[model samples]
Target: MLFGAESNLDLALALYDLGGVQFGDFDLGPTAGRSPIYLNPRVLISDPAVLRRIALLIHHEIQADQARRRPRLASFAAVAGVPMGGLHLATAYALVSDTPLLYVRPDSQQPSIEGRIIPGQTVLVIDDLMTGGTSLLRTAKALEESGLVVRDFIVLIDREQGGTERLHEHGYHVMPILRLRTMLTYYHECGLLDTARYRTVMDYLERTSPRRWSGSP
Candidate 1:
């Protein structure tokens, strides 16, 4: 019922309406290439109420994970966010859950673990989306190098473009609030996405996802 959606389907639609999901041709980046759909959870910031709802949902997930005796996120000391997207999400989570926060700077003079982050402290890395797993891996490595332990990665959306599998293969765990397949299917079912665009996006996912998990080049 959070974000004024009665069900996950409704929530997905709400996200679509909120500009979190966009259709039509797009070039995510040189490396990301062309795609028919773009998911930007950052849009949620324009509507504080909606963003708060998402932050709350993420907080609940963290709490639930902690409740599990053997949960991977049960022992984190702070929330470390990947730059751009993860920063806001981490700020929200820290506010909602009163959890400590860790930031990894993009500049040369990165903060030391002794002051900013305690050495040997467990951390859960948060990000807005995972496309190729590069940012997540970089953030994890940065944290580890600074003496923080990173065992979990959480994101608002998983593009389902093999990023999750890649992280898993590297022995890092990932959690996503919504998946690309689920989002695209919901849009199609709701008539928000035309048949052509729907097929285009799904086809892209199919073509690209295999290479990631299959260990093929």
Candidate 2:
């Protein structure tokens, strides 16, 4: 169990219940050709109880990492969320943890980070999902440009499509609450997902995984 069995299963079931996990052919833009399962954490926003559960899980993960003396658990002054989907999760986490929240506006004429702009502050980046790692990188760049340090990222779900690897290559630590494979397996075992869909997602993940997979949790 990479991220704990009970909690991961709970979140997976919650996502399924909230209709966040859809099984079908989905166009994931140019970077991700096609995906059998589409994870939309944004749906959690409509369910505050589940969203708070997620925030608690993320907070617990950070506390656990700090307890283990993980090097990437360096003290961060604030939590920055990637725009659109990530912002909502970040906001929930911030509210529950009593931490300041920040966000980046990459599409602006002059891209900038919102919230208290404090130079030399370390920030924990948050996002709803990780696919190609493009959004996280862009947000990190924006924060760095604004004199903030970003060394660790917290994503609700990792699609396992090289996003974590790509972020690792750039010297960033990613902590995902749940992996797509784990969620799919949990769903299938719980009778929420049919065998055909489970196999489809597993094959998709295997085919799109990095060539030199290190199998990091």
Candidate 3:
């Protein structure tokens, strides 16, 4: 158990049991999906060890980031987590990074006056997974409207579904603790998992993702 979480291998299994991450495809309805698995780590908030480990890992990464000083990690004015799913991550950031945390709401409150951008000093929106950039884009737009420039985003896993592409389109970068493909291969190599489930999930995500949308603007 890494910090009391189910063994990291087991954690992936538990995540798999919880229906994998659905990494990218959510709209295709089985017609033309690319991924066959999905992991909603947000669902794992209930497990104390998992939650604690996530927080600790964030701490470790931050320290490591500081150690590898090309630009030298700078203290964030604040940590902004994308709402709902990102809330827990924001709290962990607040505690570990000691940075104040705020989350952005997906919808604008009133257009001209209210949306208010979850008020923070400097934000790093957080989320558990990134499949389509839909949610992240929305969060960025809201924060931007509120005068906060969302520079970097942090996520537990990147389905690699174009979330990074979408964010780039909107001017934000993503940092994920685990990339789906790499993690899956790791588990498979360790014998923690076989390929059957991997194919199911990956295929499903690829097919149904926003990439299929035409004239979507």
Candidate 4:
């Protein structure tokens, strides 16, 4: 689903202004590899205004999806934030929407989930970004184990990697507010990103994208 162009641009600018979007040769751990661009929405927490805007954007998107009768996202009874980064967004969303919030705490011998875990309750998984989807999948597995149902996953930004496809293969749906490619294009068009930097990030995304290139590099 596409958000309004103005809203998208505003969000892109806000992310860049907040230092959430960075251009560099940063390491993305072993699984995700290196990239020319990196997005860290965790910075949103440092700015309450931006964080609230983000939460509202998510809330609106979910409402729009429900209005369109997208059952997977429309039928969720609660929201679950994928730990560490996602918890903050989930908390803000829960506060705004009055929806029950859930999270898994796998820090103990008997790992368990927080919030009211009614069996068979549908949960919408929330996260800041998507790379290979390992964290989201793990969170979903934990939720399912606790008798909660998970079908819809939402993120602020999608890295345009294999994350969405990977989750789809596992029968889960992903909804990203902004895609890295789209943001890059916007930035370049608006002069926020130079031509060279734009091309570099675009090329990097294509080469590392599982959809374009087979197997991990």
The TM-scores, one per candidate, come to 0.87, 0.93, 0.72, 0.92
Worst 10 residues of 3 by lDDT: 111-120
Q: Which ten residues in a row have the lowest lDDT in candidate 2?
A: 208-217
TM-score of 3: 0.72
lDDT of 1 at 95: 91
Write model 4 residue lDDT over 64-123, tens digit each, in one string.
Answer: 777884454748889999887988999999999999999988675664899999999999
RMSD of each: 3.1, 2.9, 5.7, 2.8
Q: Write the per-residue lDDT of candidate 3 for residues 110-148, one digit (tens) a residue.
A: 423222244444566778777776777777676677777
Candidate 2 local lDDT, 1-217, one digit each (tens): 2345697678888888989989789999986788887888888888888888888888888888788844556779899999989998999999989999999875797777789988999999999999989999999999999999999999999988899889999999898888888888888888888998789889888877885366544
Whole-model lDDT per candidate: 0.80, 0.87, 0.64, 0.86
Candidates ranked by lDDT, best first? 2, 4, 1, 3
Off by over 4 Å in 4: 1-3, 69-74, 214-217
Clashing pairs in 4: none
The alpha-carbon deviation from the true structure for residue 55 of candidate 1, after best TM-score superposition, in angstroms, is 1.1
How much is 152 displaced in model 2, in angstroms? 0.5
Better of 3 and 4 by TM-score: 4
